[model samples]
Target: MVHGRKFISVLTLTVLVLGPGAWAGTETGMKGALADIPADVMGFVCVPSAKALDEKVNKLMQQLGLAQFMPTSLLTLVKEQTGVGDALDEAGSLALIVYEPASPSPDELHNAAVILLPTANAAQLLESLKAGEETDGVRPLSFFGRDQFAFSKGGHVYIGASKATLKKVAASEKDITSRLDPASLGHLQTLDLAVWVDAQKLVKLVKPFIDQLQEMAKAQAQGSGAGSFTAIQLRSMTRSINMLTEGLESAQIGVSLTPKGLGVSFLMATRAGTKMCELVEASPSTDKSLMVGLPADKFIVAGGQIMQAEATKESITDLDALFEAEELKQHCDVQQLGTIRDSIREMLLALRGASFSISALPESPEGLVGLTVVSKVVDGQKWMDNLAKVVAACKKVTQKEEVAKALELVKHEAGAATVEGTKVDRLSFDLAAFTEMEEKEVEEMKKVLGSDGVSVRLAAASPEHVVITFGGGEARMAEVLKLVKAGGSPLGEDAGIKKVSSSLPGKRYSEVYFAGDRLVALLSSIGKVTGNELPIRMAEVNAPVALVSSSQGPCCQVDVFVPMEMVVAIKDTVMQLMGAMMGGAKQTQDDTL
Candidate 1:
């Protein structure tokens, strides 16, 4: 068997054999009954027996005066247990023989009552069953003050007020109801269950308003802005009504439908706790109105202590026009500022009440007799300027240093003057200084280039032109030319040069050429050359060529093949140029010789 089952079997055996009073009524009975419960079942057992009893009583109370409360039905459902039957039989016999109040004395009745009280075994059985064990034939007993009574196979458990206690409760309830408005009391009576039935519901009702005010507070914290005190006042009123409802004895419910929206409040009071809940929904017609006061002891319970709570909500809408009216603006003026401050203080007291901690400013300022004013006014860029104008006007009217100091403090505390109006602060890498340094370096390079004979000129050249220049004389420019050739070539080789020419000519020039993939020609000559390698300084006016018949063919050979037509035409042009030059040269030569 499981450990839990084994333990339970052992406990049951011990309890059945042991007599009454062997275990303490509270501790030992609970330990013995719950020792064998599994971890998950322990939750049911660990819950206080009184709490379970209270829940059972509540359930039975709901069934009161209904068809389910019939005596035979109640007996079959709630009281047909072996242990309960035995206890009732014993009590009934004693009542008939010894506690016949009509014939017996009061002392006999008292003795009979004492004997009818729950025995140790009965109490233990009841406690164990209440710890989550199922019971059969449990029923409400009308004789036991009309509260709930249950019977199990093991024993019986009862929950109810005594006759005298019930009378006192009824009387107290009557007293409280008498003071309330008759309409309100009637409205409260219509509720089906107690107001404190669900604490979460009450929290839901008030949370939205609190959340709205808190948002406004956070915005106010960021900077000077218009705050929704009107919203705060409305929420405070709702909280008060909710607290009042939660603390009522009759489980009364009240609902109000104003132009602003619906307001629902519930009140419930019990021996353990009292609670009130009020929920409000804003309507279309709410104006620039404020609820001014609330009760000090709003949510006090039976133990004279306040409950801990968190009240916040997520679905509240904004009341823009209500907080932004011109009349509200007038209320914030300098002359009326004191009234606003006092109103705020009163509103705070109403909302927080005496149940919470509240600190207040002293009645008078110490060491400084200055007027201090606090208000949430308009939000705009010009707010500070307007405030400064007001301070200047006040300074002009008053000569007191305290007034100036007070204005200064307001300006400082408000943090209005320190913020830039339009400019936003931002961080960026500083490239401006780097750019200035670059410009200076470029200027130095220009000066150095001017002093050197070497000139650097940028140009655009085609691939063929660049290759030709690289192969001819500008081999120093091959690096860039080779890169372009490599990029464009399919097979990746330097092709031979085809043509090379310079734009400028007639200057003293040197030739350093390469041919057939090697240096071959490097001569600089002014005279013309013949096919036979004969230097022709000057050609004859009428030149003859010898003719010879060779096996190959009849050939006319000359040191150079100068056509007769080209020689005659050249001689005539040369004689013309010489005749003009001879006249000028002889004239100069005759004078010199």
Candidate 2:
């Protein structure tokens, strides 16, 4: 326990000594210094210049209008204590290398990491540390025991578990020459702060531990009915664990501030010939232009190609087995459940691609938000027939008096609406049909769903494609259906989407986009019902966030980012909220007096 606490404390101290924005660094400055660090370790974090990072980050925060919200007094106090602040000021770079423990014990784990800081004047840095011992900064850290735990040699200060570990790292001659890809090295140099994990090394390191855990789970599942459930869950977890560690090659994540915006990006590469890699490999029908027909006014838009329907169906099947366990089989009809599962599998098999969008249409009569879903199927007519069958099955179950009353609460009316000179099937719902309700509640539902309830419309754009709209009324539905049937300026060409396009992969399995400010406003509009007043009127800007997931053979990459304007909008909202709270507190105090 003592060693564990010491380990955590030392890590916390590193952050304090480096000050704010310490994690942001440039890799160009770390070229020669990388030679001292071992490349075979599980993972490592590198910061090229603490002073430079602090300046860069502060400037970014100031530009984003968030500098005022950050608290830095604790950082100042820690720097004053450790004196490593001055040391880092003259340092070229700082690194923390982590290794797999020989055994999963606190002490062994404690010895499994090392810190290296390369400074111009190692002697001056060492003197400052000695000076801190006379003060409060280095006194509490006496357990590190004199100069043995940390020592300076050849322009680098090494800190480790003990003299033995320190010596080993200091003596290590391995460099990160061919260990990292050139592109990865480029990312390291450019990103503000970056972490790279060698997944292959990680798998080797954790294999023994995983094996032990599996065995323990098996033992626990041996003698009871509940144990069977545990075994099934453990089996699922272990499979996922194995896939991540064994099937992945490497992963890198970094926070960056570009001229356009501040965001974090993640890249992952999977190992060749692995099941996970094969699963992510792109298919022929994977469409990158799926978002083209989506409405530009939407607050949220998500479109994607189904990559692994079989895997999804299999997981659902597992759930079915779980529900059918001996101790819990009476809660549902197993036969009907099986039928539903089969129906869902059939639907999954039929799905080729889908896209959906949500918008808070404040300009509409209802002053509400709504959703629109569009799917490109193999056969639109067949899909609709299957959907009708499912709905009929649902209606059959509502014959019971209680069920009938419950169902009546959502009064459904089947109708037809014209779209692009063609009749489209439609179903509209009156949500509060069976209960006495206030006008305010109806308006509230309108505020959430664009209508008092929902309007589902299905339009067969072609024999092969189907467009569906939910919640938005006739005009909105007609507009969406026209876009699908005839090409127009896509959602991808929208200003918000354009802003983050450069950050997204050229090809992707799926993508999602968010109108940040609109989402904030929508949430704020519903705050009264949740008993909280969200500060939505604080910003007058449209900031968008986008996410894309793609795979190039075995390498699968996902990128999520927002432009810098969104950061500023978020900061402004937070500042206004804080001011309001403070004012309320002051008013309360004055009233007491």
List, residue by residue over 388-469, the lDDT tens digit for candidate 2.
Answer: 5555444444345766566455433333656677567765556655455588877766656666366577777766667777
lDDT of 2 at 299: 62
Query: What would the per-residue lDDT of candidate 1 be over residues 508-560, giving only the tens digit for each residue?
Result: 11111112101000110101111132111232222121111101011101111
Tell me, by TM-score, which candidate is best.
2
Once model 2 is optimally superposed onto the true structure by TM-score, how far is the C-alpha of residue 469 displaced, in angstroms? 1.5
Q: Could you give me the TM-score of model 2 versus the true structure?
A: 0.82
Report model 1's TM-score to 2 decimal places.
0.18
- The superposed Cα distance between candidate 2 and the true structure at residue 382, in angstroms, equals 1.9
